[model samples]
Target: MLYSAKDYQRVRKEKEELDLGRSQFRRDFARLLHSPAFRRLQGKTQLFPGHESDFFRNRLTHSLEVAQIAKGLAQQINKRTPAFKRRSIDLDLVEFAGLAHDLGHPPFGHNGEHALDDCMKKYGGFEGNAQTLRILSRVEKKIQAAIGPSDDICGITPEGIDRRLGLNLTYRSLAAVLKYDNPIPLRRKKDTPLEKGYYESERELVEKIKAHVGVPTASTKFKTVECQIMDIADDIAYSTYDLEDAMKGGFSHPMQLLAKVGDESLLTKLHEKVAKEVPKVTPDEVFAALTDLFMLNGADTPALEQYTTSKMLASDAKMRSEFTSELIGRFMRGVSVTHGTGADIKFSKVEVAREIRIKIESLKHLNFLLMIMSPRLKVVEYRGYEVVKTIFETLDSEEGHLLLPDDLQVMFGRLTDTDSKKRLICDFVAGMTDRYAVEFYSRLRESGASIFKPI
Candidate 1:
């Protein structure tokens, strides 16, 4: 095992009276499963907007699928590798990481994430991954604040001062989700894109988690073997299932992709785009992967009939089920582990083949070009940006403080720093669901509405 028994213990002491026979890892999974942050994922966007159709997946369903894939990948590695067999990976920890991975994504998906990042560029830039760390460490309410006798109690804080321990999760469990260890820059750099990392405010807490997990203070590596498994599982789920959702929503079909695969100009564009990340992935390799997956050459009918017939085939429930299952199995079986030479290292690192990795990336690029970059979706993204910006501006105004929830208003008053106030407002907006954000925006713009209506 990568971690010792002590690493599985929580920072805060467990209640003696409530002690259960369940393992510590299972307890960590249970804590994440019951969190409000996890529940809110149901209303957040995944591929398509959540309110658009019941057919499309929201963040919650995606997380569940990712968890399933993560556990399956862990089992595959455990069965295949001798090192992993000797010191088995914890299935529960892998699942916990996958489930908790996307808990920080704001409403409207990546579009909302970009907008929030842009808004908070000067106040320690926002990123969904960083927000995930924040949620686990300080946003969600699981641990009670350590209080002083004379201090005034506040929302989320039992005492007037913030203690910043949200779930107080076990170090190993927390380490599984610390996908990025670097801190978000306090100032934006010229010509650089916004990136995902932990918040600088939580630097000390991250170090403490690392220490408890037995990671050396001077070690440069951030992710553990379990974290790597979860990351790959996330990629597998995103590439395959998001394509499934897109196909179901009439965005793209395998036959259409088959046709595109043969187009030299389009293939050139795809190669160029993907090579920006993976330079060794050749155009022929991409074409071969697509052809193998879709059986492109086997379709002999006329082009129009092929398009219509392929759409019908794509719409078949049984075919979609089998296709996704096969894809997931193929990817899962590709996982393998490599042991490090050091005598102190107890666990081996996990990896997938380069071909499989590139194939997954190719599928993601196809999804991006066909669904995400579509003009129709861009309109929705634009409107979502306006909604988020408007809400932030409204709450930031002097008189607009009255419109905030009583708890937030109290928090705003208690926090005197400009950056802190902005962060509080950003949190309020970021916590909103897709439908609630629209509803809130509508309520704000209305001429007259029920004064009793709660925000």
Candidate 2:
């Protein structure tokens, strides 16, 4: 076996019963599925809310899809590689990683993430990956504490040590969740708001995962194979699923989006317009210079074999580029969600192959340009940050912090500096649902919204 039960560290004390040769990692993955933090994902955003439309996916749905895809990929690779087949990667571990990957996302999609990152910058800083670690190891602790001897409650399990606690997952499951290697408070200080990995609040959990895996600190810099599976599953889902959502929203037709690619005049105009607004670039000339030097100059490369061989193959290289561009354009128009049987699973390998991953990523960069960093989005961001900031202001106060459970409140008091306080504040904010955040803001702001009302 690639990894034995001993290769994993169980967070909760276990009696070492049920020596199921499937390995302890599989059991750990199962525990995560039953955790409250994982359940919270059902309410969080994937691209948009579930109420927006019937076709789009939320984080919970997305996580499930990623798990499926990761399992398929792991199985495929294991079957293809002799060594992997002999002592193969565990599918359950990868699936669990994919499922629990986004357990830390704040409400309102990436908007909430950006808002919290900005709000907590003075504290310890917030990134989704870091926040995921925080959720599994800490915020979930609060949820456990809230349960408080309530055996009558639904969804409560007392399988291991610390009955009311975080997902006490095995180390293998946790290791698969750590996609990026960079530590919190990023090595190079920047204002981009996105970090390569988790926060300082999760140092202990990180250490535990690493120690259990027997990975050297330096070797832990990249993702494990399971993590890679999860990451690729994420990319596949985002590239294809987001495209479907964008198409459903009617921002731009799939075909129309494709036509814009490699069109010199259009590229020139897009560069001019986008450059003026993009934070990373100063002017159209600079944008054009950068694009040509990097993307455009390299665009005419040979088509990947996958494109040539797919059932819905693009016959010409130019057409292939156009199809890829259209796919991205279709995805970028916008996103919404609705309730349905969840049967839409069509995906294009030509769109997400290694050769096209970077290109697709470049187009999704518009997510930064048109949606995330756009001024209109910034207005929403401003409001979100303000809401979070005000919540922090209230919660960090003597009385507000006291309202929390004794342990968290004590942790808040024990924190000595602005950074620590901010992290505590993020812990509070990150745990909120969309309606909860709005309600909390209203209550704190005295917005005349009824405190007795349940959303």
What TM-score would candidate 1 get against the native?
Answer: 0.91
Which ranges in model 1 have alpha carbons more than 4 Å from their true place?
16-19, 150-160, 189-192, 216-219, 261-265, 276-279, 296-309, 341-347, 447-449
Tens digits of per-residue lDDT, candidate 2, 1-455, equal 34645456566656655665655666667667777767777776565456667766778888997788778776766666555656566777878888888888887667677667766665566778777766666556532433334653322233212233366666666777887666667233446546657776567667877666655333324456677667766765675556455445544333234334446664555555544434344334433433432232144544443223321222234543454455434332221111111111001011234234433344444334433454544676667667766776677676777655455665565555656556666777776766667777887666747646642
Give the TM-score comparing model 2 with the true structure, all chains together: 0.70
lDDT of 1: 0.78
Give lDDT: candidate 2, residue 108: 69
- Number of the top-ranking candidate, with TM-score as the measure: 1
Going through the candidates in order, what is the number of backbone clashes in each?
0, 7
Give the range of the ten consecutive residues with the poorest summed lDDT in model 2: 339-348
- Predicted model with the maximum lDDT: 1
